[model samples]
Target chain A: MTSSTERSERAGAPAFALPFRVGRALAFHELRERTRDRWVIVISALFALLASAVGLYGRSAEGNAAAITGPSLVTLASLFVPLVALALGYDAIVGERERNTLGLLLSMPVGRTEVIVGKFVGRALALCLAVGLGLGAAMLAAAPGEARTLAALLGPTMALGLAFVSVGLLVSTLVSRQSTAASVVVAIWFLFVFFYDLGLLAILVATEGAIGDELVSSLVVGNPTGLYRVSLLASLGGENALTDLGLDVSLPSASARGAIWCAWIFGPLALSAAALSRRALR
Target chain B: MQRLTLEDVAVRFGRIEALRGTSLELRAGEVFLLAGPNGAGKSTLIRVLLGLVAPTRGTLRVDGAPVRADRAFRARLGYLPESVAFSESSTGREVVSFFAAARGAPKKRIDEVLERVGLADARSRLVRGYSRGMRQRLGLAVALVAPCELLVLDEPTGGLDQDALTLLWSVLDEHRAAGCVVLLASHEIALLESRVDRLGLLARGQLVALGDPTSLRERAALPVRVKVAPRADADRDALVQALERVGTIAPVRGARALELDVQPSRLLELLDLDAAHRACIADLQIVPPPFDEVYRRLLSEAA
Candidate 1:
């Protein structure tokens, strides 16, 4: 008689195909859960309100909404997108663990890497939809002719969201408590969006020009939020936005910035997967 | 899937040894019940078997081939945790569908499992509205969404009411009839004793005893209670004198019946006495030791 193992093996899907299949299922479930929770609608409405406010402010200040709203929204998104991404992702894994669902999820015929990937993808998609719907509607109504710039702005904003979501997932994986993960992600947001540039400025001022342009440029690129701002400014036909306004800096090429954003997106996610695979699910 | 063995499996959490040199072989078509007190490593053993916890020293083999709990390997196993939790936002149907998809079960199986677990009427209701018993049934639906070679449940009947428990037993029977290996850890020994094909008692991170109920009772060697109802005109003094020679007669239930504790080995002697005094004995009932008592005795001995 054929062993039960052999029979199951025969009935099972090919091993290579299982990961993506499982990941897709998890991703879909996660998306459905978030959508049902009204997370997408709430965040989307928040984004729309903020983007519209920025448009009105730009129109009143610059007298040319189309020219000003695109770049203004880019700057606005640099701060808001990461915050939104962090809020959405800080509890992705840790919350599941706290609620006693992570073990059940891992108990399925799915790999840890697949679980992390699925969660990231699902949350990233939700962020994308929120940002797209919220900002897209506002930009179209406020700056009908700046579609190109709006399109350019959306990519980096979503990229920044992905990067921070990856960071949030990494935090979620490394910590056991949701509160700790939340606190850490908040600190990370402060360091990157607020304190990072201040610290950089402190170094530049203290050094009194001792920090060269290359070092300053590399330092700006080191922070994903800064990289997002610079990339968006450059893509919107303003290469000297960072150098002329902030410091003496030369931005990397668009392709190089794209590659770095990809790194920012995948690097922490890879680490999260590795850490989860080694973790003991009790 | 025919035979899964954990050879000398051991697990330690820092300075605490949760399991030590635990070895077990599970075969198809057998329901093995694991019984123990709190902190007796029952959950730890279950975790070790599910590959959630890596044993500090041991191997898990399926049909004699060493295997990890990879996707393909776990595909043949279904698990119900002690506390079953789901995303409160998802409906019962959606939750079951998700697990079915994860296990590569057909879409049709979602409705089948929901109906099987008696969640068909409330399939569209969100889980946050479910009571503890309903959540348990949903968990069972998730576990039963797909067929497998092994079914592992940990405290599956925690919040189940009578009907849900009936459903659980029927599902277990289906799996057992299908030749699946069912491994469960529960404190409900009395309810599960007669259903289990084999019983393994764990105490202080070790397998203290393993056998069928009859064998375990024999090993425990606890006294069996024999109750005899005598006819109103029968000779109670003679019956008591005859029973006192083989066992200790209890001083209760005056005149209506005679109750005594007799060793299992001396049961035949008591029966012979009953046969000789048939005219005086109206009814004779032999009650072996309760399973929980046997389980407690074994645990104390191991301790």
Candidate 2:
């Protein structure tokens, strides 16, 4: 459709649309392919089951239907979302480069930023579908009342997935091999989810809880996982999930948590896009 | 005017020069064959043309404008990398469709290209199950998803069978007929002979020769080899003496025959030499120097 008029119209179109089209198309295709993958299938099923189990527990419990004890589903999400996100995105760029397909892609009209953006969108969408449906099923089983009760933790949990996908994208661009990228993502996931919080706890106790609420909130916001835990604990205003569990940790304001989540999602993604465009791309 | 021009392009990887002062121009309706041994910067050249690798020095222009700053200029180019590997989960149709979408091409173009590449039958099959040749053809389909002003194929025929090879040639023929410039880099000499409009012999990242096949042969100035066997080993000296009347004759160390370097101009005269020279009294082999020989000699000389 490179007719004289069509070409002129395309020229007149917003210059920004070109990169968006490339990224969107890539994301669409990535999503289509990932949806068919057995790994995605397994993970999605597991998430649905876990979310449904949480919802069912909440429904059967004495807590009001909206959620039970500060959306315990956040804990499950902390475990599964990153795992799924890592699987979807850890190899997005470097994998293509390693396989020699990245050259073929760059040879097209698409730019490097577009490719990275496309990959991020693809992985994010795939992750969203899995975690959203699973968690929705959980809430449905729990019949979580108004959807408002789960809002704080749900956003942060999904943001955590996006953050890890961004992290995975960054890893994909920086590393040269798929296996290496995958390992780095796994190691980072372990640190963020399992180890980082444990170390945070040990420090808090060793220092005799001398850390102020602001310091504790700052430290928690530093890690998306810890941010997710606080969002859930804070959202349970009545249940006092944190105090009941002896956590007694201070949580950041909504605006601050929102900033942290946005940073988690967008920061690594921006870096990934920049690094890929700068890559030598042999 | 040249459809594409690379002026004094030098690509340095760290301290190593992958492409050194390689300046060349290509025109529409020309099939440019880039023949060099492995690591002679053939792939690097194609990568630069595709704008995949930024040249460390000099400039590359397409249609009279520097394309490095205008990444969008690459829309008019199609490139098939040496080895194409896609996500294993994607079917051939999905792979081609993704490329087609990326190129902003029509959905129908995917089927057309796949059918043209003989991959239509396998389009529904996952690429993980594809053989090396099938994957290459899939790559070709991706490159052909849209019309291109310039087509750059790196080692296009490495894993292709005879049928695929024929298809590739025919496709190149069509592209040339449509006045598309095609840059083909391959070690395979078979695609170099008559199909190539211009053969570029690259060695050590420099373009040593850039001309038609016939002109390159003429430039090489290689002599035609005439191997002769005397009726008996004792008759070889007599045959050598007579053959020297036409051109240089050297003894084959292990054979009863001697190898004579026949000048192209003196070939007819040598044929007219007395049958009694007895050098060909048993068997004869007239070896005309072709492109491969010229290619080998150029690379060795560069080394």
Candidate 3:
């Protein structure tokens, strides 16, 4: 007989792809594959060497661990970590689509949420490893005393990195072409990380310091990287820099910056996950 | 066993009707070959079965129940897309293992599927260096790793060398023997005409014809050709004269033989070489319209 009768007589149903294990598997797979990406590897190595050099140089120059990764490290990390995130994740979804591997990956019993979340988890793991190995070397090269400060600094940098990675994923889902995604990522990275503060500064100058403390605080918290930079002040750097930049207010406290960091970390990541899940495969 | 039934399924991409309302059934234990010209919506239909593309309207029921593309539902399917690719830096073994885990299939399947696709030796070689045929084999291995209620392969045979193709056919044959449905969309279906249980011809987003080879031949309404080959150096006219008794004869293209469009029923009689005809004719060949011709005629007719 044909299929209908045979299907009726089948003994058992097939096993499903459990979300936890599948997501974990995809995470690891993505991590392993990202290791092959020249950009990721370069950034990873770049962070490692830069952190170690800073730590060793600070050790010789000032003999203090805190001095090694202090305000300078925070500023440099603010500039570098987001680059790592965007460089690695800019093509997360659309890259697979271009390689034609997205269909293969999605054709399995795994869900769209699994793909996005698992990728983030994997990239996050890679981000931590890169930061830990790269910057960890620097801390180790210095006196063990500054481990506390380094931890504080790494936490927000990683959060900032994750925020950018999530934005990259959202860009991947929002566009079909890899070039477009990469371009969008560069524009976003430049605008928020490098140029937004300057644009805000220009506004401050044009208004003759009329931009009030509350307005400055809200504006800083608005851009993800800006939020990341604010989080940086709480990590290790002092808040006087914001005032000199014409903020005219005290730097945000640690708890408030923590909240902003959490928002920045989860906000884009969640939205991108939603976008990926809602977008049709075909 | 699985029964794939599409009831008036249609897909619209903005202004383009990629697939129109079309009803069809692919029963278990049959190799259903889907054939069509470019942009004929064959790929779209295949995607619908794989659950990659949802139908704009109508129902796709697997075993009498409407299904969505979910983990449980997709677990019952094996799909191989037209453009097969993998991480260039990953070894064949790593690539297979990654997919196996993603598929939730056992790690033990790694060895069996690799052996089946004849990639055991190249398992350690990175996919970047694999030749076209080897990569195609890897794709086949990925599809064969999981147990599937329905096997959906879009252009599965493209780029496969003879050895790889033979292995793929054997694997698919085994899949059919297990009573699972095998749906393939390939322009090269004519090459496996003898093995295809049913042929689906899609044109302009419509299923133009669906049948076994003989049924399609009947639907196509094309003639059967009978060729009478002469003994070496024998008179071609004598063979022609002999065939003229049954039907009008023409020269077999580039051969020392005479061809006739005799009724299929009378081919055996024409083949019987009695003493009178035996002197002129050495052998008789009956040629029916191949699937490719039938495919072209079906598309043109539908158009």
Model 1: pairs clashing at backbone N, Cα or C within 3 Å: none
- Give the C-alpha lDDT of model 3: 0.77
lDDT of every predicted structure (CA atoms)? 0.82, 0.79, 0.77
Model 1 chain B: worst 10 consecutive residues (lDDT sum) = B270-279
Candidate 2 lDDT (Cα, whole model)? 0.79
Docking class of 3: acceptable
lDDT of 3 by residue, A63-142 (tens): 55544456556666777788888887888889888988787777777777778898888888878777677667777876
Candidate 1 lDDT tens digits, B25-94: 9888889999888888898888777767888999888889888867666777889988877888888999
Superposed model 1: Cα runs more than 4 Å off: A1-19, A38-41, A57-62, A65-67, A205-213, B227-245, B249-259, B271-285
| Cα misplacement distance, residue B292 of candidate 3 (Å) | 1.0
Residue A74 in model 2: shift from native, Å?
Answer: 1.3
Q: Each model's TM-score?
A: 0.90, 0.89, 0.91
Share of reference contacts kept by candidate 1: 0.59
- Chain A alone, model 1, TM-score? 0.88
**DockQ of structure 3:** 0.46
